[model samples]
Target: MACGPEGDFARSCVPSITTSGHRVTLLTDDGVRIEAAHTPRIPGPEGPYAPSRAPFPAPSADLAVVLAHGFSGSLERPALRRTAAALSQHADVITFSFRGHGGSGGRSTVGDREIHDLTAAVRWARSLGHRTIATVGFSMGGSVVLRQAALHGRRAAVAGPGEHGERTDAWPDAVVAVSAPARWYYRGTAPMRRLHWVVTRPTGRLVSRLGLRTRIHPEEWAAIPLSPTEAVPLIAPTPLLLVHGDRDPYFPVDHPRMLWAAADPATAELWLEPGFGHAENAAGPELLDRIGRWIARRARRTD
Candidate 1:
């Protein structure tokens, strides 16, 4: 049930401060500039999208998590920082941008191509010596993480099942999706429809024209390998967790509710907050504690 060697590289942990001890750089892969940064707990948060600290010396800090931001958002969100701060005890964490969002390359694939970006980042995380990785995603980032799990499986094999075609030994032992939209295509959506129109037409067009690929992927990306909703089944038996607020208006809890319902009973979980929204953990401690505990439980399971 554990991830393979690839998973071992990703499960390493080191305490990191978002502000300092980190420097931003870009790694090139297949002609793409993946924005990357590294920080130690000594360096604290300075600017937006700066990376979090890895557990120093790796594999020594106990555990680690990788955090991906929501659409139109960066790692600077207060909810994220607060949660990261609280979860620091579990492992060293990393926060990253998707392709064009924040400080990365390419344009958003609307959860289409960014999954590639997430996969590549995980590869990088695994290489750093992580053992049990817990992917915590918000909104679209949540979708990206889920898609990565469903499609490519986990980069690390020591953590969980990595049965996807790649057959990596390492994989994420635990997965958390917060306020994530389960079925985007099934939409008779008002907000997403309106939001889609806004981004795809004027905003998307404007940014696309400017050569700025933010949330929407460029037209050149004609074929995508998978859809976020399609990858739901593959996450089973991997300790999948879903958290959403009742008041979440972005993509109704009904979506995540359905996701939890559809997920494999043996490997999935859902937590619906009474008055949370798109991301209530942004300002709340209780949610952070819940997330931390889930991550800790998964890491200890391997121990």
Candidate 2:
């Protein structure tokens, strides 16, 4: 019992829990193939708790939320499945495997090239005719969402073409980044140090491939991409929510604080949870429900 692919499969085998969804294939701008899954929202219970006011509401036809999982995670991960299930209460949810995770093609460049993965997912969401869209990311994925939002912001909208050719209205209406690091090359924490070893050493890469089912690219960044703190400033106008747990082992509260300080107060909100741990695993139903409500409100306003 560890929570690897097999563990996820075993859990899904239980008669009570069903983790089925529509599977998809996506092509990144660089021509990498990404595996994805889409789950329509589950309607809330009727009666006393109205759908509109319920913690989990009926799905909105106009809104869809793209979920970005942490490193070593895929759409099949139980934690990610739980996250997607919770968000599906309000809007349709699309979860995808990043470049080198699960069945996706190409090797992971950690967080650098993962932006394209997210971009492709968002574009797919748009193509489905969703009038509003949001992105919620955890851990390494948290940084990707921030960078993606900034890179596609109105100010930098024309910086480059999207997965296809069009670049207009390709960004998200709201963003939620949980347990994201503020800067690059952070090895202050033990977990991050172990993660660096996994990404930096050949033996570590082999271990990741065999043990964690993740394939890591064995090259250094050609140039440093924008950090989360650096990207936060450009997300203005669009709503941003930063959620970090005080008890997280990979990153301390200072990381979220840095992102908050760099963001525009008019549109950015930060939540520092007390007992929460890290990423999708630590995000419980209550927290996820709250996030869903926030996205519903923010996306409605943006629309």
Candidate 3:
């Protein structure tokens, strides 16, 4: 259901308009259909909207931030919307549902093949005429964004055509990973152990589907994809930011520290926030604002 005056009016009068942004369908490399939105920043303190293609960036907008939600989170989630709202203050924002989440197709591969989803979103942002792009990911998404940036790199030789024939530049000018795990198969914390069960067991997968609305793929990772620590070293020349709450329950500060140690000091920055919790839900407006400013500054500098 739509909330607030604008969303309610749009829902009642214009049934097709549910969100405060333009709805888009992104096709990943593996042919999964990813649901997405383009939220153009407006003046004052309010949510964003891009009613038509002609007024995408408005006059002030130049950069785009692609937000990747965590394991169970979706583009439609309230927390994710708030994150978009906060980031849209500085740039246009693109938020998308990973496979098996929200309205997207296919099953979630946790963090493995989800890189394709992030890559598709990045390419969509680039196609929207934003020469500069930044990616911000939370939890599982954080790991995916790190791997995506490493795989594509900023200096990718070809602007190759994607599955849909759209020109693809899967790399971003800057990246921010919040509450991401440094290495895979980490079952150190209580939450991590529960998460492992959710992905590895049949009953837990059923609970995830029925209770959380997040569909999990039952098969194990055929091949271990690149870990976040391994990916960090490859992200130099493109600015990277790793943010982890000191009180984060899932993965401790060691995760971010491991990633930071792997990254080039000149290009990578780590923020161990005080009293902050995990991912999108724990990120308040003030923290999001700071993140938006940080990315905006870094993107401009790198450009």
Candidate 4:
């Protein structure tokens, strides 16, 4: 098993770190193809460490972490790669590009249909024989994680109907959302206002395509889908961590506060870091390692 330099598989484990990760193409329920990379964890000579908190049990050896990038970001992005490198120290890492971001098919629905993309990634992680899986999302990807968790919970809650058969096999074990917006269509901040223009205006869309290399769908949202605040309550019983920078330029502190309020305090943990920016950019090596340990601790829990 080969691995990257910063990856745990590199040191004291494998002799030569040549060919490491494999590519996985997941077809979402909506028929969109998502490109993903699966980097399996390589155990070191030291073995797994016990959790700092006793509440969480020791995680399984087959634990996996799925990384979801923000808008205009992909698996190849430097920020995402840095995050993956840090997380790779604790567990196996899986990174993917949401639709319209990288090599994935279909235009970005911003946060609406992107749930399919996340679901597909989680499902793919499970298919690889990983008993425990954790999802970590940044920015737009963060909203997608919340919605995906809620969608799975909603399905499980309403599994009696004809179309809504039981989908217990589809849900992830843990979730982390960084710099996610609690409400939709928020134009409070200047950055958000500019982002809205880029997403809603024709000239901005053209610039997004040519300059950012991201394709946004022309169709408008029919109705406000379940907002992140609305979705948080449904994610109860599943471990959730909401991380936000107090200095985020896009969404203010209120966004994370709203999400924290909506989520069940018993199962949710919120981290409001000072002087941090937004998403992957703000997540430094120490922060990423801390996040990795947080997820690893929960992933180990059997109850």
Candidate 5:
């Protein structure tokens, strides 16, 4: 269902979440969750998303951080943990494996279906009353974050500096994309030609074929799906921080460089990490501090 002028989405339209927290929850008429998690890590040693959470960042901050994992990746990646730790200072953090990835249910839809899951997740966070939300995604997850920000993240309507589409109604205050692939998969890009089979194609087919919730759902890019370069226009004027490694194996280093070039410049920002390659396990302390402070402008600087 489309978001109404009132922004109240119907509950029947919302997707279900496999692992939320200690308790199982109900849905609303808007198809969104009114409350996601009361605590960061759920009770007991059996917590699935808990152990992956940061100890000091306390997942109860005012702002809600939604961290997304990349292809075949889980919520346990070191980068997500590090990012979550840094984010803990200002908001309650929410990190989940996408539908088909980790302990979550459903199949990966590449960008097509994943966007819905992300939308639902964002709506769930909004219901928590955090008032502000931000996202950080790795690799493909970076694409997810950018889409959500362009479609619904905070800075969707920055207006004049760049060429953001007017259709944007939802958004995060700020967006961080770590090693984002500006060129999408499936339709045809250097990454797809090189990385799709191991990274995308097979996974997409598996998601659709298995009907199981662990695969990434396939996205038909040639259709209406937004390409990475196209999304930059929507993020215009909204703060965009992109991190790409110079030595990334999957895609060329020029990918981010081209992305930065294609971007309108007056608003978006890009950071190409020289030594870090691809979706890294750890971001240096300097990068960590930069991310932490960057998230602070919109979230809360509680930490």
Candidate 6:
């Protein structure tokens, strides 16, 4: 059977595999309700191996990856669904709609509060009994993953118990950020200029609501949060992979380079693709397969 709209997987292309997937709604710490889908990995014969663009240490089994979509994008986007389908070859996949997009509730704070959205998804993945969990995000979601890793990784490392006396640690074991920006309030490119207008201007906000079905928050960020580059250093020990396209019209090569420079080289790997453009839109089957293999290898590692 075909996958459901919310990514409920009844059957898959691999004939010998039988795994179940379902739609779930996650409540963020801040109380926003986010829409998500969970698809367990289908165990079967392996497909062609795609070598990693960059070399890294091998890894754990039964890995789970949480996919965060970009601004104005939803879990229903074809590109994201294709990515989820491709990734399911190697691991269980969970895709979620950030607030202000798709079926999720609340207005977009652009990238600021989205960290909570990722946190909720990561927590859900952990609750599923997957010992190894990774988060893969694109564009705005990429920024969210970096910040989430930085913020929650530290908390999870030292946190004791919650208000309900349950452990509050919800950080992922690994993180992959694609086409993420190095800093906030960037308007270097025409697309970003337009995006700024969409998020900050009244008319543009209306257009976003009507044309894009995205509801952006009207107020400016009360205070500047930790930039993606700055957040990189805090994600140490946890493996990190930064992927960017040289031809990207959004943030350009400097963004990823800055992020790589800020990250600890021993624990981070950066891949600068020549022809790729942006996030999921630029992630083709070959790229996705390569990423899947890389993540699978990382998940298998004990250290």
Off by over 4 Å in 2: 1-21, 46-61, 158-168
Task: Give the TM-score comparing model 1 with the true structure, all chains together.
Answer: 0.76
Best-performing candidate as measured by TM-score:
3
lDDT by residue for model 1 (34-70), tens: 5543333222355222344442333332456777777
| CA shift of 249, model 4, Å | 0.3
Cα lDDT computed for each candidate against the true fold: 0.62, 0.83, 0.83, 0.79, 0.58, 0.80
| Model 1 lDDT on a 0 to 1 scale | 0.62
Model 5 lDDT at residue 128: 48
User: Model 3, 1-303: lDDT tens per residue?
Assistant: 222332222121111233465666666767777888888765455645444445233443378999999999999899999999889888889899999999888999999989888987887676667788999999999999898888786644253542234333567899999999999999999999999999999999999999999999989989898899998998888999999999899999999999999999999999999999999999989899999999989988977
Estimate, for each residue in 159-226, the C-alpha lDDT of model 2 and write its tens digit: 56533343545689999999999999999999999999999999999999999899999999998988
Off by over 4 Å in 1: 1-21, 24-30, 37-61, 77-79, 154-170, 186-189, 207-215, 280-283
Tell me how many clashing residue pairs each candidate has. Answer: 46, 0, 0, 1, 21, 5
Give the CA lDDT, 0 to 100, for residue 117 in model 4. Answer: 81
Q: Over the stretch 57-111, how does candidate 6's per-residue lDDT look in tens digits?
A: 1222468889998989998888888889889888878888999999889999999
Residue-level lDDT tens digits of model 5 in 1-303: 222333444332233323323322223222323222222432245423343332223233356777766766655556666665665544456665665665556655565546655665565565545566777787888888877767664454444222323234346666788877777544344555644553356764664345433454454444656777777777765667778877676666677776687776776678877787666354666776677567767344222
TM-score of each candidate? 0.76, 0.86, 0.87, 0.86, 0.68, 0.85
- The true-versus-predicted C-alpha distance at residue 167 of model 3, in Å, is 9.6
Q: After TM-score superposition, what is the CA distance of residue 253 in candidate 2 from its true location, in Å?
A: 0.6
At residue 242, give the lDDT of candidate 5.
78
State residue 168's C-alpha deviation in candidate 2, in Å.
Answer: 4.8
lDDT, candidate 3, at 75: 93
